[model samples]
Target: MAEILNLVGSKIRDYRKAKGLSQDQLAELCGFHFSYIGGVERGERNISLENLAKIAETLKVEPKVFFDFNHSFVQPPSDKKEAALQEVLTLLQAKELRHIQMTKKLLMEIFKTFPRQ
Candidate 1:
């Protein structure tokens, strides 16, 4: 609903201001147009998933982070879940993770060369 979008926009503006990020600066970090950031903050434009993801990444947070009314991150995992997730992550082959990292780097570079609207 329009009210939800308005809330999201308000939250974005508040968080951005708290972090001392200008619309231009945040847009640059997300590789977006400054106008787009302004529109988003004003709830005047519909945001796309990709752009939302990019904004979240640039803000160094998860996408769900932006939607939360409190604007706070999920607390660090409890001991049990932390241990299990750590074990799982640790068991992932180093070489496979390295390959994934390399692929991500390559894709970022390739995308940077594309035109931005």
Candidate 2:
């Protein structure tokens, strides 16, 4: 139970950072106090489902995403190509949805124009 809380807290922190939002900013958006946000992130609070939903909505992610611990352990890239892919993923991780969609479209067009052998 404590471990689950910690995991959820860590996931929330990761998403919050990825979205480039500070604790205060996220708290403001979710109508929570900054201290509450900090507590949640630190696993010091047993967050309620209602509060969790609010945070999830504010973060623009589904609440279930926070519980997806199975894929949380990312292996380090083993090769140059994999490293490059990881770099690209990291770059896109912080982008807005529309920006990511635009990037995907651009990449698709470029690929169509230059087919791989």
Candidate 3:
């Protein structure tokens, strides 16, 4: 349905921003025109299978990632360092973030106290 496509569009735009990719960059990687990316993002155009494949490959995710429009953050597996880092980062308020910075500095200083032993 058109509404579904718009939801997909917004999700794609969110992922695109999170990945720090511009529409032009994504379009180039997918071998499409910049307008095509814009149209897709605007939900004014439906993408073809080939475009979907190219986009999936360039985005480093499966084609179905485009359709999995969950707004909830998908935590990485327990084995992934990034998930742990994300957890740590999310614990911070602005003041807490400042404390985190100072904690990191203290840890760095503590580590520097030891020589190779």
What lDDT would candidate 1 get against the real structure? 0.74
lDDT tens digits by residue: candidate 2, 1-117: 889889999999988887889999999999988799999988999999999999999978889988988656334456899989988987887799999999999999999989589
lDDT of each: 0.74, 0.88, 0.73
Candidate 1 weakest ten by summed lDDT: 69-78
- The TM-score that candidate 2 achieves is 0.63
TM-score of each: 0.56, 0.63, 0.60
Instruction: Candidate 1: list runs displaced more than 4 Å.
Output: 70-117
Candidate 2 stretches greater than 4 Å from native: 73-117
lDDT of 3 at 55: 78
Ranking by lDDT: 2, 1, 3
The TM-score of predicted model 1 comes to: 0.56
What range of 10 consecutive residues in model 3 has the weakest lDDT sum?
A: 69-78
Give the Cα-based TM-score of candidate 3 against the true structure: 0.60
**Candidate 1's residue-wise lDDT over 56-93, tens digit each?**
77766667756877433323344898877765454543
Q: Tell me model 3's lDDT, rounded to 2 decimals.
A: 0.73
